[model samples]
Target chain A: MASLIACPHCGPRPKEEFTVRGDAGITRPAPDAGEDAWYAYVYLRDNPRGRHREHWHHTSGCRRWLVVERDTMTHTIYTVADASAEGETA
Target chain B: MADFALLHRPALADAKSGSFGAPSTVKRITLAALPEGHVLHVLAARGSGDLQGLIPRIGDGTPHAARPYGPGQWFVIGDAPLSSAEIFGKTPILDGKASISDQGHGRVRIGINGAAVETVLAKGTAVDLALSNFPVGHSAMTLIGHISALLSRTGKESFELLVLRGFAESLWDELIQMSLEFGVDAHTGK
Candidate 1:
C-alpha cells in the first residue's frame, strides 16, 4: 500500500505517514448511565439519509483531529476538516 | 503546485489569496512533518459564537463552510491549527481520551477547485453538495468509493480532499477523471 496521506488534522500528506483509525462518532455511555444508554451507544445508530459524521485517526501523520461526513446509504464523502478547528466563540 | 514542496502552503492561500505567505509569518500553524506511528493526542472543539468575525483574527480567517460531526459537533475550516490551544478563545472544546501515536502512515492531499467542484464531488460523494446548505467553509469526512477521506470546502469554487496513502493513487485517478470536465491541475507537493 502507499505510505503518505494528507493529515486529516493538517492537510495534504502521504499515506505511509499516517494511520487509519476506525469510523468517527463513536459514543460511550457514562459510568452511571443505564444499559439503555450503553446499548444505544454500542448498537443503535441514527443512520440518517443525509449527512453523517464519522471519525478517522491520522496516527502516522500530524497528531490532530478529524471529522468526516458521508452519506449513510451511499457511502459518498462530502468533506473533511480538522475536528479541532471548531471556532471558540458562538 | 508543480513542485510538491509548494503544496505545503495552506489551501486557503492558493484558493482565496492566490499568493503564498511566508511560512514563518503564518499564525496558528503546525510546523511538523509526517511522524511515525499512530499519534492521537489531538484536541478538537467547536464555537457557537460569531463565526463571521472570528474567522479573520486567528490564521487566514477566510470564510469557509462547516458541517456536523457526532452529536452537537461540527467540522469547520479556518486558519487555526487543530491543537489543545485556543483560537476563538470563546468557544468550548470537546476532548477525546484515546491515545494517538506518531505513526508515519502514507497519505496524500488534493484540492478540487472550479465551478463544477460540487458536481465533481457529487460523482463519488453521497452528501448533498448544494451551495445553500453545504456552502463554503463546510467540511465532512466519509468514504469516497473505497477510500476514507476528509473533505473541506475552503471557497466558493475550491475544496481540500484528504485521501489515505493506500488509496492515494486510485483516488487521484478517480479525481482526475472526475475533474476532467472542469479542468483540474493537481500539485502533489511543493
Candidate 2:
C-alpha cells in the first residue's frame, strides 16, 4: 500500500522508504544498575494504551535519530522530535 | 549499455502529456511499469557488524553508507534484476527471503539540476541537506517543505525526487517557487 509517514528528524516521507524503529523513549539501564532496572530495560515496556513515544530512523533520507509521540490505539501522531523526555524522569 | 539506461523509468501506457507550467516546463505523469533490467537486490543482515559484513563484498568497500537504514532489512538499489539468490551469490548476507514486485505505485518523479539545487532543497528540508552526506550515488528519504519524498542523488547537482500522486501538485508548486531563485527548468519522461 502507498502510505505516507513522517520522519521525526527529516519530516514526512513515503512509508516504503522509512523503516519503523520501534517504541520510543526506551532507555537501557546502566550496566552497574540493579537487577530490577536491568530487567525492566531488557523486557519491561510501558506499552501505554494512549499516546506513546516511538523511535524511527529516516532510513532513506536524513538518517538521523528521531522520537515520535503517537497514540497507540489511533494512528494519530502528536509530536516528532530528536530527543525524548524519558531520561529526565530518572 | 547507456548511462541513461541506468535509469529504470517504468513503462507508461496511454500517458497524458501536458505543459506543467510556463515555457520549458513539462512533466510526464502517469502509472507506469518498472523498467525490466538486471536488478541487483542487496540485502544486508542484522547486528553491529552486519553492515561491515557488506563492505568487503561490494567492491572498494564502504560501511558508512549502509548504517542509517538499520540492520535486518534489505537495501534493494541496483541495475540488475537478479533474484535474491543472484544477489546472495554476489554477497552472502542477502539470504533473507526477498520479496520483489513490479512498479505499481503512483509516483511523481523529478530530475532537478542546477547550481542552486541544494540551496533550493535546503529551504524546505530539516535534514543536513549537504552534498557530502548525500553524495552522488547515495539516497535518503527526507521531507522537502515538510513533504516527504525519496531523494536520490543521480549526479552532481542533480537529484531524482519521488513523491506521492496526491502531493504532486503542491510539490510541483513548491518546486517552481524554489527553482525560480536558481533558474529552474523541467522535462517530461516516462
Candidate 3:
C-alpha cells in the first residue's frame, strides 16, 4: 500500500482524499509584466526531480487546502500544512 | 429539534429486496438507524488556544454532547434543538477563535453494529478498522465505497457513519451488498 498523507484536520488518511493542484512557489508576474511572463505562468512548468512543494486540496476529508512538501523521486511526503494559515501558494 | 435531515435520506428508487442475499443468516450482523437527532459542526480553529471557556457549563453540558469530527472540530449531535448559538454567538467567543455550523441537513447518519461490521467496512475503505487501531469513541473521516464519510466507533461493537446526503443511498446499497453473506438486519431510515 502507498503511504498516507497526515491531514492536519482529519489525521492520517490515504492520498486519494486529496487532489494535487500543481507545483507550489511559482510567483505570478505583476499586472504590467510582458505577455511572455504570463505565457510562462500559464503554460511552462518545472518538472523538478526532488524536494518539490505542491498544493493539494483535501476534497474528501477536511475540505481544506494544504501545502505539501514531497520528493518526486521517491513519492515521500515531507510535511503538510493548512493553506489558510501559511497564506502561501504557487 | 431532532428534525435534522441527518436522520434520513431518500431511499433508492429501484431497490430489489432479497436480491443481494437473504437475511436468513442472522446474529452475525445487525444494522439500524440511530434515533433521529440534530447534528452540528463546531470548529475551534486549529491551534486556537482554549475550548473549555467556550462551552462554560451550559446548565450541565453544551446542549448536545460533542463527538470527534476533525482536528479542530466536533459534531454536536443531539435530540434537542441545536444550542451552539446560545453559548457562542457570532462574536469571537473569547479570542479570534471557534466557529459552528449546522450540518444536520447536509449529512445523514447510519449506525452499523455487530461482530462482522468491520469485515463489511474493510471491503471498501483502506484504513484499518480493527479494534486495536480504532477503539471505541474514536472517529475518522474516510471513504466508504468511494464516498467521503465520517466513521465513528461509539461502542465495542457499534459504529456511526456520516455521509453526504447525495451518497447515502448508494453507500447503503453497497453496504447491503457487502453484508449479504453475513446478513443484514435492515432497519428504518435508509
Candidate 4:
C-alpha cells in the first residue's frame, strides 16, 4: 500500500488519513441499463496489478475526494489530483 | 418537568493540570486550554473564487483568525462568543459567496508552547513542523495520534490546536504524555 499520499490541497500526508473508495475509472450505469450492467457496476472490479487510479477521500485532512494514480505492485504514487478538479465523482 | 438543568462546562475543565515529567530548566512545555470562544466554519459556495479577501471580514482581525483547511473552506475563530443573530449578521459580508456554520459549542482550542514544542508535537503527527516548511500563521488539518485537529502555528515556538469538544480532554491527556520527557505544565483553568 502507498504509505504516503500527497494530497493536492493538504500536501503529503500519511495513508492513514485517507479512506480508499476503490477504482475511480468505473462509471455508474443508467437505471434502465439492465441487470448485467448494473450487477457488474455494483459488484465487479478489476484487480489490476499495476498503475491504478482510485478515489481516495482525505478523511482526516482536507476532507476532499482525490483521484490518486499509483502503481499497485510498486506502491509508487505517480500523481494525485483533486477529484473535483477533473469533474470526477466519488 | 425535568429537574436537571443543562449546565454548560468547558471541555477541558476537568482535564489534567500542573507540571509533570522531567525537571528541565532549558526545555519545558506549557500547555493550556484556550478560552471557549467562537468557532465558525465558513464554506464557499460552488464556483466562488479567491475568498482570501472576503473571508477575513468574519474573523476578529487577529492573526490566524481565518484558517483555511481546504479549498473553499475556512475556520473563522475568535476569543469572543457570538450570538445567532451576530453570526447571521456577517452573512452579507460574503455577498452570497459563502456561508457560515456556527461550531462554537462543538469545538475547543488548546494552546501549547515551548522551546521544543515542534519536537514534542512531531512525535504524534507526520506534518513537517519546521518553521521553514510550516511557517507561522499557517494551518493544517491532520491527525495527531488518531485524533483529527487543526494545527495552527501562532509563533516560532507556539501553536493552537482546534479539536472536537468531545475529544478535547483525551487529546489534552495525550499531549501531557507526549510532553512528559520535556516537563509540561498543563493548565486547564479558565
| Top candidate by DockQ | 4
Residue pairs with colliding backbones in model 3 are B1-B81
**lDDT by residue for model 2 over A28-49, one digit each (tens)?**
6778999999988777766588
What is the DockQ of the complex in model 4? 0.94
Ranking by TM-score: 4, 3, 2, 1
Error of 2 at B176 (Å): 2.2
Query: DockQ: which is higher, 2 or 3?
Result: 3
User: What is the per-residue lDDT of model 3 for residues A4-89, given as tens digits with 9 covering 90 to 100?
Assistant: 88888767878888888888788889888999999999899999888888888888777778988888888888989988678754
- Model 2 chain B: weakest 10-residue lDDT segment is B25-34
Q: Kindly report which residue stretches of model 2 are placed more than 4 angstroms away from their true locations once superposed.
A: A1-90, B1-93, B97-108, B165-169
Q: Which stretches of candidate 3 lie over 4 Å from their true place?
A: A1-3, A8-11, A81-87, B1-27, B45-47, B50-64, B81-96
> Measured against the native two-chain assembly using Cα atoms, what DockQ does each of the candidate structures obtain, in the order listed?
0.05, 0.18, 0.54, 0.94
Docking class of 3: medium
| Backbone N/Cα/C clashes per model | 82, 14, 1, 0
- lDDT accuracy of residue B96 in candidate 1: 30
Task: Give per-residue CA lDDT, model 1, range B22-98, as digits (tens).
Answer: 22221211111111212111223334332333322223333442333232333333323344324323232322311
Q: What is the lDDT of residue B87 in candidate 4?
A: 96
TM-score of 2: 0.46
Candidate 2 local distance difference test against the native: 0.52
> Candidate 1's chain A scores what TM-score?
0.53
Q: For candidate 1, lDDT tens digit of each residue in A1-90?
A: 323334444344444334444356665667889988888777776656766765555543344556656566765567767666643211
Better of 1 and 3 by TM-score: 3
Q: Sort the candidates on lDDT, descending order.
A: 4, 3, 2, 1
Looking at model 2, residue B91 earns an lDDT score of 44
lDDT of 4 by residue, B1-190 (tens): 5499657799998898899999996889999999988999999999988999889889999988999999999999999988888999999999999999999999999999999999999998999999999999999999989899999999999999999999999999999999999999999985
